[model samples]
Target: MRRTARRAGKALGAGAAAALLALATPAGTAQAADGVLSIDGTEHEDPSGCFPLGDFAPPKIANLTDGTAWIWSGPSCDGQVTQQIDPGTSAIGRGRSLYIE
Candidate 1:
């Protein structure tokens, strides 16, 4: 009886750990609103290409200048690439680039 109880306790502990891990994992969705970006409930800004860009339901650009522009590449949380509009400068939008790099 004691051995059975010990085994049951161990199993319960393992199950609890697994549950915790599942809860800790990030969600597969992202949220964007009012020009703000978020991923798995975490606020993010100027995220790198590796970060999920979330649903591309719509494209919005912020902080535009004569030589810079931002573009949304897709309709899903794939990734975004930034391109330079000028031949030698990192600025974008001057060359009328259709998409990000």
Candidate 2:
């Protein structure tokens, strides 16, 4: 009975430690995209958050990531949404910025 109790306690402790480790580690959910976002001919891998074009509005934009994003007519992801680019797709427009989710 004592040995069984000790084994159970050890198993419980291990489980607790594993849980703690899992909590401490960063989750993959924080990543916005899992693939690439091509702007013009340039490629951005594992893109997340807002991407400002900054003076250059490319005519061709591609979203090869596993996520969707919006092409904005202005910078900072605030303003008119020119287009919504989905995964494995592309758009032909003059966009000043891009926002991903």
Candidate 3:
């Protein structure tokens, strides 16, 4: 019984250490949310890219580029296009697709 208790204690200690490490590190592998689109809770570093809206159901958050960006209401850069997304301008609505050049 004593040996079993000692093993359980060591396991608990290791688990606590791992939990602390995870909390200290960043959550995702994306760049900072400064100048990129945060699609489906993931930030894309590049200013230009095609992200399928279908991949992120109920698309939540997004961040505009430094210069300018265009947002589309449909996937594949289709549908209504909202122009002039300036710096520090966060895309409030859930755009079906985002195109920045």
Candidate 4:
């Protein structure tokens, strides 16, 4: 009975650790910025994931949200990253996509 109790305690500890790690790790689209991402002066509120910028890629961008924004050269944010705009920051770079994280 004592050994069984010990095993149960170990399992509980491990499970707790796993749960903590999961909480600490970033879940896809789970958390989002509480602000907006401005593209060419247009604000996109509560943006999540990748925002594609088709042929008319905006040259000026402003990250007014509390998240990091990545400017990608290719559509769907698959290619090179043109700029990294942080929270409350702005940049002058043209890109085909914008990823807010």
RMSD after CA superposition, every candidate: 10.7, 7.2, 10.9, 5.6
**Which model is ahead, 3 or 4, in terms of TM-score?**
4
TM-score of 2: 0.62
| Prediction-by-prediction clash tally | 1, 0, 0, 0
| Residues 44-74 of candidate 1: C-alpha lDDT, one tens digit per residue | 3433332333443322223222222233343
Point out the worst 10-residue segment of candidate 2 by lDDT: 52-61
Query: What is the Cα-based TM-score of model 1?
Result: 0.33
Q: Report the number of backbone clashes for model 1.
A: 1
Against the reference, the lDDT scores of all candidates come to: 0.38, 0.83, 0.65, 0.84
lDDT of 3 by residue, 5-87 (tens): 99999999999999999899987663332466665678777556555656345465455556455667788888888543566
TM-score of 4: 0.64
Off by over 4 Å in 4: 1-29
What's model 2's lDDT at 35? Answer: 89
Model 1 residue 62 distance off true place after TM-score fit, in angstroms: 15
Clashing pairs in 4: none
Please list the residue runs of candidate 2 whose C-alpha ends up more than 4 Å from where it truly belongs after superposition: 1-29, 54-57
50-72 in candidate 2: lDDT tens per residue?
A: 88776754658788899998888
Instruction: List ranges where model 1 is wrong by over 4 Å.
Output: 29-101
